[model samples]
Target chain A: MTAPAYNKPLLDVRGLTIEIETRRGPAVIVDGINLTVGKGETVGVVGESGCGKSLTMLSLVRLLPNKIKVRGGTAVFDGRDLLQMSKSELRQVRGGKIGFVFQDPMTSLNPVMRIGDQLCEPLIYHRDMKKADARKRAIELLKLVGIPGPEQRIDAYPHELSGGMRQRVMIAIGLACDPELLIADEPTTALDVTIQAQIVDLVKELRRKLGMSVVWITHDLALIAGLVDRVAVLYAGTVVEDAPVGELFKRPTHPYTRGLLASIPKLSDERASRLSSIGGTPPEPGRRPKGCPFAPRCGLAEPICHEHVPALLSFAEEPRHRVACFVAQRQMMEAA
Target chain B: MAPANLTAFVDEDPPVSLWRDAWHRLFRNKLAVAGLVIVIFLALVAMFGPWLTPYDFLTQNLEVRNQAPSLAHLFGTDDLGRDVLSRVIYGTRTAFVVAIVVTTVAVAIGVALGAIAGYYGGLLDRTIMWFTDMTMSVPNLLLVVVINASLKTPVTAWMEAQYQATLNPFYRQTVWVDFLLVFGSMALISWPPYARLVRAQVLSIRGRPYVTAARALGLTNRLIIMRYIVPNAVGPLIVSVSAGLGTAMVLESAFSFLGVGVNPPTPSWGNMISDGLRVWQHYPHLLAAPAAVLGLATVAFSFLGDGLNDALNPRGSK
Candidate 1:
């Protein structure tokens, strides 16, 4: 329900809960969370590590790791509940309707396989393209991702390519079947700064050209500033703030969002000045606070903030911006 | 379409496939090269033993019953005056056949069971591993001896009955019984290690990011195992298989020497060495010829295995 500019949503997730089996028993990792991605809209899912950002996305595709599972969720992608789909139907959606580009390009790609073969796998399986045709399409995808010498590079293994080049190959593979939604889970986390910028720009350009909805998951608030249309700020497995990109940057409502944005160092600061950062890490999954998960870390927490969790509500004057913080609600416009 | 000028940086290096790279690394190893040469030479000898041997291995001449090494017979004559060189050459054929066939059978069984156990963990994994452990726990020699002792008479009798009923010459070769028992026992014992190795390999390889990536790509588990998991897990397997071949050859010789394997007149190196052992004081050539050849094959395989281990996992090498 972010911005509501594009009403027809491509993916609408509701009350998605995930649990991990620990030594004690099953513990809730991702509490009841709601998220949605509109058709041809780019949304950035920003959160720190272990905030259930990656796990939430992985659970939608039924790719959760061993001992971790979806407790309850209804992930309706293209008007179908993905969590309840048959194995065959899930196969059609995975890499067909919703593509994923994972983190750590160096390790994510199969080292022994040729880059072309890896890129062509989904096309051959889902698109039913012949190997020869798949190969041609693979070359085109490599070119589309801006890799040099598509013909020669097609035969090269993952190790033969540089890290940035490997990531490009990964993106090309994700985009192979022309999925409706691309969920990039910290795709630029492992790249050099310049390379990260290039990849972000490339994804932005690809999103424009293909007009596919993108869920760019990252902890860096600054990286996806220019890449995403709206930003959803997650804290301890729950969305604390959801707003248009420009509005979120200009007026970060949630304490967690403000902390995240403040953490990004600005150039105008003194040469020797210390970079601002959130003092404490986000709460662990199962050990999250009974009330507001961010109350312990927030500077402006009131008595009510400690006693009860704040619901995400839109401001009366600025209906597009939604924030989940009691102190902000009382200080700012009325919650409508 | 991409700009043509953007592709200018790709001219520096040529493409090299993994197989080619592994071969290159293998050839660079001096000990491995030597092993390869000896293995190839022995394989050729095994393939063309009949043509290469100067005399029939079973032929006996009383006059030259115990001759030393000479121009006529490079390895001299045994107690029966049968040319030792011909017998050793024929022995090479038996060793290679037993080694290759047993290894192939064992590897097939091992890879299949291990891959299944690994890909689908929990009860299936425990069950297969339990079976593998049960098989491996029993002493190999004791198992083979028991099998031969218990089953040989019944199998030979069955073969005779079949021959009598059908008038089929195929069942007349009772030597098939000895081979069947030996090959079956050796393969049964040999597979457990391969199973354990491949299982461990698959368990690790399946968790890799590439495998997860493949899963995210919506590939079936079978396709993931065959194309993705198998290729990556094959390096250590190659090393294990090479070592297993040598071990199988040695095991066959031991069984043959114990009279539980290939019977007499078959010219197995083990039986020849057994025949040579008692009369070695008078004619050392009898024992030396077959023993030396067995030692050479074992050493050659070991060297090749070590070389392959290093070459396949180059990061582990200095």
Candidate 2:
């Protein structure tokens, strides 16, 4: 696909594969996946639980947990390959160029340290800021995240703050260094619905104000409907569809993407009717179908869909929209 | 919606840190407070015992032998006519020294080994854990006794040789040899439990989300261990240490009673109790004084440890 001349991709990950060591042997948890975030773009990575969305983002920073390793991948951020960078160079990119917000705010923070101290840590390490200067900046960050009484709240421990406030603290920390890219992995799954919206709005405002790209990974498609510039729908470790946010909403081509979009409870639905849902769970890692990973669960799967995997191809009508589905590609070809 | 007034909900009282909160909880428990008070009192007595004793513990007064509770001697006199109160007071000093020194050495060794094993895991973890397990498998008393028996002669001989060669007054003091042997043997056996405790603590804290978050922030391994992992792992260690001090005191006393630790005239409680046990039929105060004091110190420490465990882990208490 052709890229806009002015918009250079900030972070481009190609053929990223992650594996988990199991009793049997190493099993592929994240297959060859490709994703990109352009400058100042917000990309929402939507998938079901255990579909490897989080692992893909974590693998970019080499932060996968023990026994779950990045088997192969090349994540290029700002012209340099993150997967091939030296230890020291990778460290510079970690909190300095790319910040990460984990899923659970409650446990992501150091319990013994004060919020102020935790915030000052990245500044002192990455920026070489003096302790006093770091403290001042920490107070400013607290204010930026909409936390009240920045001075007093900074001294409060993680337990003292409410869940919403703690999440705000997490966001403030993620934004502490003014990173070029922020990877937030389900930053609001643990919060109340109201708090979730508040967190989304906070990130949106900060991204617009600071002009930093964001990769938000979440299982909820509806949660990121208005928050992202594009959406990459993952099914069983691979991105089945990637499209502009509005185009994806208008026409989700991949069967799995269609199922996910259909599952979201619409306000216009019948009051007492049950919510629509996909029929089957995503295949297990080692036990994935030989052909398309989603073929077993895809109702529109044909004979060829079970024999060979489909490569991601751009739609003839919209070059920006890409889908990897044999049935969808055949139908589009016939219509054309 | 317009931003809610977030400051209105702020508590009137300033925020108390987790440690301060735990301290407050500890103070509220009457039993723990009593234990703390008793421990402080005993520590003070141990520190000032020399000045507090009216009579020299070594001084022999044949005329006043076997004297029962009197103004001249509060706890009464022993078979040798030495003041029992003075000896027991002096014993307190020995108990404190042995307990403190042995525990400090053990904790240092244990923390270093355990932290390294838990953090680095794989071959190093297996090797360290194997060593810890082997050390723990041996009988505690047998190990201490074997070490004292085998090492004491060589250490004492070396001190004597140093004295002869250099005429250094420091080497002439054979009491140091006894203490050196006792401390080494006791510390050797004392460390395995702490090593295991710290290893388990580190294993759990290593997997915590905060530690992973620290790594994600590009913090060095040393920084993550010192700032994130160790601080979180120290709660259980504190409780273990409190309980350990009491156990060390008892271990020292038991060894002294068996004539293997802090040999005669060093004024350990175990030696005094041994002396008291022999003549208790005629003079029961001799045995009762040191035994009662030892019992009190042990009970006090146990209570304080329990209180600390509950205070540090509030969730566990419920």
Candidate 3:
């Protein structure tokens, strides 16, 4: 991936391992994930369902579900290790320094609560603002999110708002304290296509205005195509390829990434052709194939690819792009 | 420009809260409104019984003894020569007090224990559920009888002794012993259902995305519970508590009828009915007033509970 144009690592996650306690034993769900988001940079984490994309972000905030344990990890945010922070320290960081916008706007907001109160929660708690001040700020936040008649809307409950409006409220809540980093986990996945584009646009506009680092987790490659500065493609919990968004689109080096890109139905394709799909599912948590987790699914898998796991290596020709594939690495090494 | 600008017209109707919405729905049901009116009437009678009653309940006149229903005495006089109307009015006070206190105690215990058990889960949950099951398994009337039979005399004697030693007028009120025993015993038996309901509620709510979102917002567990979990869980609780008030009143009456609840001079409907039962062939008015009032209360609360259940959970209604 290209060096942060901001030249400061806002969030650096290394060897972040997460395990879920299944009946069998502790199954490795997220195995040594390395993710970094620079200040003012929007990084899109792309992966299929159950590939630890959400889990990776959730674990950074120590918000993993019960029975899921973080075995090892160091998520350094602004020189502080988030994983090792005390409850009090984390509380200040959460919603203050690092805001989170969760998926499923319909369910993500407290249904019984007023949208204004929900928006004002982080403000009151993090900033310790007076109720009147918080109310004023809540209206401002609602206005900032482009909710019509913010004053009148503040008193409205979650059920009264449309899905798009509710998601906008969620975004408002995330941006409440003017957080340095906003980790939005597929915030627009539940919206309609038109609404999704609008949300992307709103986020793009907000990002330019707020100048905060964003880590957007989603399965939709095309949706985040123009939104993200860098893209880290995860396959079965590992970052198979990480590169600048433009470079990744131009030449997706990892087999899984290529397969993913191919799967996206293009307008240039024949109308009758069956939409290309990656064959077989990603390996299960407890039953990851030895060597590479993607080896079984890879069409160009060599005997050596099955024998040894490939490390993420930067191509000599394109130092900014990295690919975790033995075949891709060998091919690049031969060319160089 | 003004004609086209009409699209920006804001609807000025007040925002509808869940509680307000539920209120509107509750009022829509005819049976519920009737029940609410009857309950309100009963509550008013209970609140202002002393001022409203024509005669002092304890003041007896042999001349008016066993008088039939007339303008002077609406419900008729009992064999004791005591004004039956006044006694019935006072009985309303007893029922309301017993019902409200018992339900409050039971609900407090239930909400606290249930929230803890559901939120924490594991061993705490297992133990609490086990305790709840154990409490529910025992017969309610039997448990109240056993407690009253075992403790009533001792408590009254202790109060008498305290009055003698301290010269405190508070201890002289032995009727409080009857009330305390009834309240405690009834509360003990009544809390299980509430605990179960709230535990189930918290269990379901614990995994909701909003709760996860709340956690992500770094809201404290207490705040999350108070603001998020409790409000969502309270709708069913309100319905249950309405029903519970009725149940508590019925339970109190049953205890008083069995000579285990509020004693004489307190004018309880249960004891009055018990007294009226023996000579029902001669003077049916004695039984009719208290019995009718108790039945009315039970039905009122039941209808209100049903209405609340429908209102809170709109999906459950037509």
TM per candidate, chain B: 0.96, 0.95, 0.95
Displacement of residue B260 (Cα, Å) in model 3 is 0.6
Model 2, which residues run further than 4 Å from truth? A1-7
Residue B45, candidate 3: how far off, in angstroms?
0.9
Least well predicted 10-residue stretch by lDDT in candidate 2 chain B: B1-10
Return the clash pairs for model 1, or none: none
What is each candidate's DockQ, to 2 decimals?
0.65, 0.60, 0.50
RMSD vs true structure, all candidates: 2.0, 2.2, 2.4
lDDT tens digits, residue span A41-142, model 2: 889999999999988887887877889988887889999999988888888888888998988999999999999999999999999999999999999999
Candidates ranked, most accurate by DockQ first: 1, 2, 3
Residues B219-298 of candidate 2 have per-residue lDDT tens digits of: 88888878988888899999999999999999999999988899998899999989889989999999999999999999
Docking class of 1: medium
How well is each residue in A1-336 modelled by candidate 1, as lDDT tens digits? 233347878899999999999887888888888888988889999998888999999999999988998988799999999999999999998899889999999999998899989998999999999999999999999989999888989989888888988999999999999999999999999999988988998998898789889999999989999889899888888889999899999999898898888889988889999988888888776687888999999899888888899988887777768999998888775443
Native contacts recovered, in order, as a fraction for each? 0.64, 0.62, 0.53
* lDDT (Cα, tens digit) per residue for candidate 3, span A249-334: 99999999998898999899999999999989988889988888899988999998888878888988777699999999988978
Model 3 spans with C-alpha error above 4 angstroms: A1-7, B1-10
